[model samples]
Target: MLALLPLVILAATPIVLLLTISTERRHALTAGLALTGLVGALLALPTAAAQAPRDVTVLLRVDASGLAYAALAIVAAACLVVIGYRYVGAREANPEEYYVLLLIATAGIVAMAFSTHFVSFYLGLEILSVSLYGLMAYFRRDRWGTEAGMKYLVLASASAAFLLFGMALIYAELGTMTFAGLVAASPEQMSNAVVLLGLAMLCASIGFKLSIVPFHYWTPDIYDGAPASVVAFASTAGKLGVFAVIVRYFLLPVGAVTSGLTTYLVVTAVASMLVGNLLALLQTNLKRLLAYSSIAHMGYIAVAFLAHGPVAAETVTFYVLGYTLASIAVFGVIAVLSTEPGRTSDLDHIADYKGLLRTRPVLGAVLIAGLLSFAGIPLTAGFLGKVYVVLAGAQDGHWFVLLALALSSVAGAWYYLRVVVAVCSTPDGESALERPSVPAAPTAVLAVLAVAVLILGTYPAPVLAVIESLHR
Candidate 1:
């Protein structure tokens, strides 16, 4: 079971390469690669569950947590492939290179999930980050793409430096870089000063990756500048990978060093939630709104993290999985709808959606489902996810955090409902009521996502059971 991990990862390479070979072959290659990766990942799941937790080396470990996150990444990647099929082919960019980068990024995310040591974690992060830089700037001729790439590179490089320095401090104090070793060496061999400083740096570094409050300056610009498909990848898969590592780190018992970290995290979480939602209310562009929305969503996940217990871990994992699925679904709709050649995701403007129900009822319905899920409406996966997170927070006696969450939810409703209202509004122009054509592949993708959202919401037991079994 353990032996199949590397094999599954390697299997994705050939098809990813095929995506770049020629225009005529791009769609088939991308679809094949996505399907192959999904199957390989799913096949590995039972084995991963059956096998005892194994240490591949000091740097890599395969545990239930890692397996869960890897599975989520693979699923999200598969959805993105379907969402991107039409957009990639229509653009002037090389479809093959785009898919190759995506596969490499997926591999990096999986690697990150299984990493047991700082060295492996950094390696996985760098691989994912570098590929994303190119993916962000894939439309090189476009100013938005180029600017977004540059901003991402500079900010990401700075964060990487901080992360390396923090790792060095940790290693110097403990003489080991592995998480297990660090936990074991604490108290007697490690001091509060070293641990606190190291953790602070680590928080700052990861904050950049997760787009948390102070380090979130780059997210909106990048999301607005990049194509919708790339933004989708960054928002869902990239964030989940970082959260997987963050959960592992926080779950470790580091004694007094971690004593007040929960309070600090709770404060940041509330701040992010308030700030992200409030700022989003003012944004006219769809990409920027979603970017801010992503920040707010991360804050909710952080609330679960601050709860700091077995239930917290379970809640966080479930929330991340549900949120990732919903984001992919929402972005898939955006990708198909925002397919105009020169435009970015700005095409998802509220006004652009006016009379969408009249024009494209099926697409409009799918969009409504996705938006309602994001808004945490009843009978949607997002609502269940929020309930779990809020319950975890309340369990931890985080009344203020719970209050902040409630307020943010109320504020969030305005923007999401605005879109729905636009979709149902009367069309003023002739083209406004004209149905937008979505190909069979994208239509099928939307259908699958819509079904998954409903299923996860109505009968969340199966997935929740799987999450419950994933204890460290």
Candidate 2:
């Protein structure tokens, strides 16, 4: 019973907030409610972990691995909500509905993290996707926001369709939708064309969510157009939930026997790494550059994911948490530097940050750490993540993928250094260095994330122990 408490709290919080919160309790009070709920859910994780490795229902499993990822999703959600207080309050928008959607989306993320059956997985994915549609277009007055939301709706819906069709195919072949059932049947059904095709279709949708190659068309536009706060949530927590599902699915016995699926992932991982980094080099728009960078980072995560070795799970978990910390810190800076509420972001261009170090030293330092982590620089979380992923690849004997990761890191450094130089250089004009008002909530969140990145990079043993305990 205690194992399901966090989910109960998450699902109930949005409903209670929607019902009880008055219009007078607009942004601050409503955001406070959401924050309290997320913190409560996070607090419940230890209890959930205590009773872990137990199946709570036909659909859900309470376990260390799921709880760890759920914790990551909850933390990311909390950071977004904390930052949203200022962003939503300043905009000409309905703050109550924003919190409602955010809470609901968070519930979906938690559901995905805990899911063990296809029914729960499909339902969880839809809940998160639908809620995000509203959050992405929260600023209805901005054409960019509305347009981005619509594009996401269309593409995401199409991906969901592929996912459903794939599920149907697998069910038709094996007469089961449970992960355990699928694994049990794989030895006999692995050769079936229907099962193979079904797996392909399922992977296609996951590719879109992670913004891997070929299916990643919507990432840059959506990231560029959405509010920075929403982008942070989607980029961090959104990916956390989806990847949780992917990791669970792949670790099952069935994944080992499906040669076609393994081949498909290898190709996609390599392509995403090379293509994503190459495209980022051509971008001047800060949001778009980060969008492309996310694609590449997804590819890096995949390296650890596909390894399926003894340390593979631990490697993936550490790398994921590390990446999330770096991402939230970077976007927190973007959220703080945003001058106008509903307008297109002020930190749009690379040139916009000239002399930022002189004007806003703290924000500049945080941004540098975040970007360097992305580039896999030494003494940063991102570097540790890359090192782990590479070690996993070596353990699995995936030489081609390892080579791709190494080459892409070099290409990634060039673009990241460009932004660093822009931040430190003299202002191009008087207008360039004028410091924006730094909101306390977001600034504090940025500080926390920066410290977390450093801690995880320097002393990862504690986190590694937690992840090791979670691994099946």
Whose TM-score is greatest here?
2
* Tens digit of per-residue lDDT, candidate 2, span 1-472: 8998888889989987887565365667788888999999999988887887889778999877788888888889899887767767776556678888888888898899888888898898899999989988887666788888998898789889988999999999999888778778745696798988887888898888888898899899999988888888898888777877767766666345366656876888899999999999999999999999999988898788767734767888888898899998888777777746455543678888888877888888889989999999988889999998998888858999999999999999999999999988887666444755677767788888888898888888887887787775
Error of 1 at 10 (Å): 4.1
Report the C-alpha displacement of residue 35, candidate 2, in angstroms. Answer: 0.7
lDDT of 1 by residue, 441-469 (tens): 87787877877887888999998998888
Our tally of clashes for model 2 stands at 0
Clashing pairs in 2: none
| Clash count, one per candidate | 2, 0
In the order shown, the candidates' Cα RMSDs to the true structure are 2.5, 1.6
lDDT of 2 at 146: 84
What ranges in model 2 sit over 4 Å off? 22-25, 253-257, 341-346, 432-436
